[model samples]
Target: MRIDYVINKVAQTHRGQSEGDVAQAIHDQLRAVGVVPNGRQIAQYANAISALPQLPPNATKR
Candidate 1:
């Protein structure tokens, strides 16, 4: 799954929250879009993202 995309999408509205909090936000958004992840899977993605390097910028203007 595109975990990074989901995490960043959720982060736009939930700044300054813990990874767990972010994970929950992501879960809700996914559900809203009818994409239900496995139980606790969002939290797992959140934890995984925390250990990886930061995501690159969305798209730079020329």
Candidate 2:
């Protein structure tokens, strides 16, 4: 699970929202995405992000 990809996904889903809003949206999405697939969403999200230095990217960004 890529945090940057997740964050980008959340941002696109939540277009026009501020960065903080985007962050919250990502958190919620993470929880939603985690509960049913590989494992607990929150736990997976937490562990995935806990070691990260920052959020992911938007390949188009220069």
Top candidate on TM-score is 1
Model 1 TM-score, all chains together: 0.50
TM-score per candidate, chains pooled: 0.50, 0.38
Give the least accurate 10-residue stretch of model 2, judged by summed lDDT: 35-44
Global lDDT scores for all candidate models: 0.66, 0.53
- Cα lDDT tens digits for candidate 2, 6-49: 75575445545454454456666656767333334534444444
Question: Which pairs of residues have clashing backbones in candidate 2?
Answer: 4-56, 34-41
Question: Any residue pairs clashing in model 1, and if so which?
Answer: none
lDDT of 1 at 37: 70
**Top lDDT hit:** 1
lDDT of 1 by residue, 1-62 (tens): 55556667765555445677767877877777668676577777666554555555569755
Candidate 1, RMSD to the unseen true structure:
4.9
